[model samples]
Target: MTLGAVAVLASVLAVSCAGVVLLTEQALTADLDQAAALRARDVASLLPAGRLGTTVPGAGEESSFVQVIGPADQVVSASANVTGQGPVIPAPKDARQVTVTLDSSPLGSEPLRIVAVPVHLPSGPGWIYVGTSLVQLRTTMSTLILLFTTGLPLLMLIVAWTVWRTLGRALRPMEAIRAEASQIGHSDLARRVPVPPHNDEVGRLATTMNAMLDRLEASSRRQEQFIGDASHELRSPLTALRTQVGVALAHPDPEHTRDLLATIDQQTQRMAALIDSMLYLARTNRSPPGSLTDVDLDDLVLEEARRLRSIGGLRIHTAALAAARVRGSTVDLSRMLRNLGDNAHNHADSTITVALTTDNTTAELRIADDGSGIPPGDRERVFERFTRLDQARARSSSGGGTGLGLAIAQQIAHAHAGTITIDDGDRCRGAVFIIRLPLSAHHGP
Candidate 1:
């Protein structure tokens, strides 16, 4: 890029200098012609008026040739340089000046620019001619051309060098950024690009790159934490399954072995559930929702409530359900509802209330359980993955959950452009998990 820019600049400079040289040459030529005409006018004024023949002045320091001619088109008097030459130019029909070139002259074979002016002299009507050699003018123009041709390239080279230095200094910071960025790796996200002192584009780029590194580092830490938590959760079930199987093998009795096998199956199911939840979360994190359709949220709520009702321990109240439709993936919406219902069932003391309703623009589903209510401080924390609020709410008689239900529910809600929040229950002194989704366009009656 620098080379290209320098090349273009040099081209423009060369063209401009050439134009200046040409213009200078033309201006010099015009000045010389004007001086010759003035000399001719002065010599004509000194001659006898209405004269036919007059001795013109000799060649002077400025190297001009003068001549006087009679009305018969014969040279009567001539200057020293053109002493024996015939009339250098024909007499003009009028007094106006005219330019002519003399090809043959006593001085040399060089061309001369002559100006002829008709004058009325005492002897007769005559013409005066003033001629000047163009050798000096041509020489001056040649010198100017030589200087321009030689000096322009030197000037262009100097300019190119200066521009190259300036651009290198200006881009030094960017080079530093590139070098630092190249050294950064996934394991070293803590490193940042150096910011320049000047608040220019380079500085902004450095700041942006540092900000991206910050995000990558935070994301990496979260990933590592998630893997650690998942490994711990999986190990518990695997250890229990191995111990139970080992005990069953040692006993080898049919009834005892059957009980042991049943215990092993339960543990296996728990592990399967945990793995399934992790897979669901991972899938959702990796991709956005696909195949959206109008989902009847009320029907999903009622379905989960009915399924929980068959569990038989708690009374499920879902009479407040209304036709609430939302646009989202049906499977994701169903998973969200089931997660919320399962959480409520696991925590409720005696009764769980499931209610669904809609306002003008939003569909709301609230699931509350009559258990030890979640503290204000712990409400949000309980929704984090692998969080078990066993102290805040009693663990279900069935077992402690894998602690991913509320987190998965929240992820699903957010995927559908919705929000899930914890608030006080409307019917009982328990925690209420409210899910709010935007209403579909065709939702109204």
Candidate 2:
């Protein structure tokens, strides 16, 4: 980039210098032509008084040659430097000045710029020609050309060097940031890029990168904790299964073996459920719910109520059921409802109520039970993975939950751009899980 910038600047300087030389040449040429015309006019003024061939005062300058011509274009008088040369230029017919160039002249064979002006001589109407050598103009232009050719490169070199140093100083902070960032790893995200003192672009970049690293560190810690929790949760069922099978094998009794098989099946199913829940959470974490379709919240609530009634022998009520539509994945919506129903069934003493309703912009589903309500302090904690509110609710069920159901349900709710909160049940006088999802545009009035 530096080289490209220098190259472009140099090209502009070259063009500018060339233009200056051409303009100087034109201005100098015009000055020379004007001087010759004035000299011709002066010489013509003397012709009315002085005789021909008489040496005129101030007419023998080294750079100028003056001559007088007759009607026939013959030289009648000449300056000392060109005394024998014919008229330096052809005689003009009128009083207007004409500038002409001479190939060979008394001025050492170099070109001469002569201006011929018609004048009324004492004898008749003749012409006066004044000529000047171009050596001085040529010398001035040559000097200008030499100076521009040499000085412009030197100037460009100085400018390029200055630019190079300025850029190096400006980018030194970025280089330091790159070096620090290169040394960082997943194991060490606490280190941060250095920020320059000035509030410039590099400082802002350093600040942004540090913020990104902070997020990455937080995410990494959460991932590690999740993996650890999942491993611990899986180990319990596997250990129970192994112990039961070992005991049954040692006894070798048919009835005992059958009971052991049942226990093993239950443990295996529990493990499967835990694994499935973990997988769902992991998948959702990696990629949130995509391409939402309209899901009937009322249908999902009724379906989960029926399933929970058959499984838990709890009286399920849906008196508030209404035709409410939400935009989300149907499968995820079903999973959320099922998890809420299971949670309500596990905690309820005898009845689980599933209700659906809608407001101006949101569809709300409430699942409540008549069990001991969750304490206000533990309400938020119940949604965390692997959390079990054993103090608030009983954990004496034949197949206790894996504790990820409510967490997964909350995640699903958030993915649908909705919210889930624990509140006091209106009818059950127990904990109520209120889910509010954005209403789909196509929902019926």
User: How much is the lDDT of residue 204 in candidate 2?
Assistant: 96
Residue-wise lDDT of candidate 1 within 168-249, one digit each (tens)?
9889999999999999998888999999999898899999999989999998997898899999988987898888778767
Regions more than 4 Å wrong, model 1: 28-72, 76-85, 89-147, 312-324, 350-370, 376-380, 391-400, 424-429, 434-436, 439-444
Q: What TM-score do all the candidates reach, one by one?
A: 0.78, 0.81
Global lDDT scores for all candidate models: 0.80, 0.83
lDDT of 2 by residue, 172-204 (tens): 999999999999998998889998998999899
Q: Candidate 1: deviation at residue 75, Å?
A: 3.8
Overall local distance difference test of candidate 1: 0.80
